[model samples]
Target: MVGCARVVNQTPTLPIKGESYVVLPFENYTETPYAGYRVASILEGVLASKGYNLIPRVWSINERELAVEEIEKLKESAVKNGARYIVHGSVNEFRYKTGLDGEPAVSITIFVYDAKENKVVKNVTVSGSGWVHESLGTLTQKLLNRAF
Candidate 1:
């Protein structure tokens, strides 16, 4: 069996490097519990691996969607942390489909918010499916790595 993954869509320009960023937990819209947090953790690792400076913060709420108030709060937190950018978004899908192969599918949208400007600088949506033998987390990481 062969495992495969592909990026569905993404913006042409990447976020500038050498800027400090604060990564907020992604909102989970999937049936799978804590899917947002799971993806956020993976994204943090990916950013760190790429040598991006990350500002650590503790988020107690597990948001299921990105409400306007939530976004404002996230922006405020990013500004307080002195981060140039805020990273967040939502997980639209995260699960293994019901089929003979049972492929692991993941769909997520990422947003890069400019803390100083209080605006979203860039946004990208990417999705992929893994082979039957592959794991969901591994596939998710692969797809996110392509976001930048």
Candidate 2:
């Protein structure tokens, strides 16, 4: 696990229709970096499929791409790329015993920001025990529902 993000500048309002945006790589606060990338990809696909104008995932993302030191630069890049909103997310993957069963569960949190306002329009956190392959899809849908 790594450092967690300190959220800033939040708003209670949600985004309207037809807003363009980019799905930034979900910050990796877990032991595995690949898990973070997978989370990000899930977010991008879900948001796009739900009818949001999303930036292509493969066209603009990588591990360690958005350092804490580059907040301003990242914001500028997102704006220049025609993103009216920016999606930031994180996950904590863990395993715990539920009665007789030992299962893997993921706790995910996602933030949707209105770029010009620099405010978090939506934030969601969800956790459930299951295989990553299946849980990822459920978590992705939850994030998208909150985001849109």
Best by TM-score: 1
Residue-wise C-alpha lDDT for candidate 2, range 1-148, written one tens digit per residue? 2222222233455586488888766666766555666777777777777777875443355545456545446656887888888877776662343554333456677788888887887876655555333444564455445544
Question: What TM-score would every model get versus the actual structure?
Answer: 0.86, 0.69
Q: lDDT of candidate 2?
A: 0.62
Candidate 1 residues lying further than 4 Å off, grouped into runs, are 1-5, 60-71
Q: Pick the candidate with the highest lDDT.
A: 1
> Per-residue alpha-carbon lDDT of model 1 for 1-148, expressed as tens digits?
5656667676677567788897887878899988888888889899899888888864654545456577668768777778899888899999999969899999999999886777788899999988888899999888888886
Which residue pairs come into collision in candidate 2?
none
Off by over 4 Å in 2: 1-13, 57-66, 70-72, 94-102, 131-148
lDDT of the candidates, in the order given: 0.83, 0.62
Error of 1 at 53 (Å): 0.8
